[model samples]
Target: MSLEVLAVDDSRTMRDMIRFALEPAGFTVHTAEDGVHGTEVLDAIDPDVIITDINMPRMDGFGFIDAVRDRGQYKATPILVLTTEAAPEMKMRARNAGATGWIVKPFDPVKLVKALQMVAG
Candidate 1:
């Protein structure tokens, strides 16, 4: 089955890249500009996985993860942090916020898809 994905990032290029990577792999992609917008998008789609950037206006990835976990239906949903930051502390923070995994920026499309399958499949 095709996995549905929601990608939240402030950079339009990043969102586009994610779409390009995932779509051809047979994954359905949805995008949001920031955490707040991500939350809004979440209300409309029942995605199997979510990929979000750490830096954004209105709300960041941590806040986005927290918000997603707050919803009962999405409490166990897999949230993956996809960002440029590779700091251990940041990864810990995302883990604490209920993220399923973390991926550094400029990710390999194959690895990204593998991670999603491992977490959400």
Candidate 2:
């Protein structure tokens, strides 16, 4: 089945890259600028998985995860943190905040697609 994804990041390039990586893989990709925008987009679509970056201008990934978890319908939605930060503590923090998985930045397109399929399935 094709998955619907929401990718939240501050960098335009990262969003475009996510779109490029997922779209041809048979996933429908939606993008947002930051946590606030991500929540706004979330209001409109119920994505199968949410991919967010750690650092952002308005609200960060942790906050975004919290917000997503608070929503009753989205509580079970898989949230994957995709960022350059690979600190152990950061991963734990994301886990505490309700993230389903984590991936380091400059991700391989094939691996990313595989990860998303693994998590969302």
Candidate 3:
């Protein structure tokens, strides 16, 4: 099945990487530079899942998750945190903000597709 994904991150390379990884897996990938941009993009598309980085300009992943959750339409959409930070506290914070899961950076493409499927499918 094809999944619609929104990936929010400040790094252009990271967005590209996510696109490369998911596109071949039959996923349609959308990208934004940061959380603020993510919300903007979200207005036009209904994503099956969202992936975000912790640190970003304007709004961070925590705020993004909270924002998405506050919108009733997206309250149950699975959000995955894709970031470099893997501290226990950080993961807890993401959970508190309503992230469905977390994946460390330098991710394996196959694993990411599997993860997206697990949550979004």
Candidate 4:
């Protein structure tokens, strides 16, 4: 089955890259500009996985993860933090905020797809 993915990032290029990577891999992808927009998108789609960036104009990734977890239906859903920040403290913070996994920026398309499968499947 194809996985439905929601990618939340401030960069349009990143969102496009994610779509380019996932679409050919047989996944359905959705995107949002920031955490607040991501939440609005979430209300409209039942995605299997959520991928978000740490830095954004609106509600950053931690807040996004927290907001997602607040929704009962999405509490157990996998949320992956994709960011340029590789700091251990940041990773810990994301985990604490209810993220399921982490991926550094400039990610390999193959690895990204595999990680999504491992978590969402």
Candidate 5:
């Protein structure tokens, strides 16, 4: 089966960028415009990996992860967070909330793909 990835961000540009990066690598990329929408998509698709931006409307990355983890289907899913915030505390919070890995923005496509490979593997 093809590996599926959920790319969550508010910006169309960011979401499209992530889709471009991951799709060429043989991944099926699904996108969520915001955390609220992400949850709805998650229920339907159940992507193998989730990469979300911290800042978003209608429920942020942390909220998304929290909601995902609460569900039986996604409890053990690997979640990678991408954010402009680089504070240690923010990282810690993400970790505490259940992120498997983290990346700071302005995102590097190569590194992101590598990270996706690592997580997907």
Candidate 6:
């Protein structure tokens, strides 16, 4: 089956970038402007994987993850935090909050695709 991925970020450019990279990797990507929007997409799509940013206008990535984890249907889903924040504490919080992995922004597109493939597959 084709992989379905939800990419959540406030920046349109960032969402486009992820879609550009991952679409070629055989993923069907859907985007959300922020956590609230992301939650809506989750309900509509039930995507196989989620990639999100830390800072967003409406509920942040942490809140997004928390909401997903709180829901029984999404509790075991794979989530990857793709953000500009690379601090150890940020990674720790993401890990504790149920994210499967964390990736720093300004990331190499090739590497990012590979990592997403590894995680989403």
Quick one: best lDDT, which candidate? 2
The per-prediction tally of clashing pairs is 0, 0, 0, 0, 0, 0
Q: What are the RMSD figures for all models against the true structure?
A: 0.6, 0.5, 0.5, 0.5, 1.0, 1.0
Across residues 94-114, which tens digit of lDDT does each residue of candidate 4 receive? 999999999999999999999
Candidate 3 local lDDT, 13-106, one digit each (tens): 9999999999999999999999899999999999999999999999999999998999999989999999999899999999988999999998
**Per-prediction TM-score to the true structure, in the order listed:** 0.98, 0.99, 0.98, 0.99, 0.96, 0.95
Q: Write the per-residue lDDT of candidate 5 for residues 17-59, one digit (tens) a residue.
A: 8988878878899999999999999878978899999999999
Give the alpha carbon lDDT tens digit for every residue of 31-105 in model 6. 999999999988889888899999998799999999989989888789999999989999999999999998888
Segments in model 6 whose C-alpha atoms lie over 4 Å from true places: none
Error of model 6, residue 54, in angstroms: 0.6
After TM-score superposition, what is the CA distance of residue 1 in candidate 1 from its true location, in Å? Answer: 1.0
- Better candidate number, 1 or 5, judged by lDDT: 1
Error of 5 at 7 (Å): 0.7
Q: Candidate 5: lDDT over CA atoms?
A: 0.91
lDDT scores of the candidates, listed in order: 0.95, 0.97, 0.96, 0.96, 0.91, 0.90
Worst 10 residues of 4 by lDDT: 57-66
Worst 10 residues of 1 by lDDT: 112-121
Worst 10 residues of 6 by lDDT: 112-121
- Residue 6 of model 4 has an lDDT of 97
Off by over 4 Å in 3: none
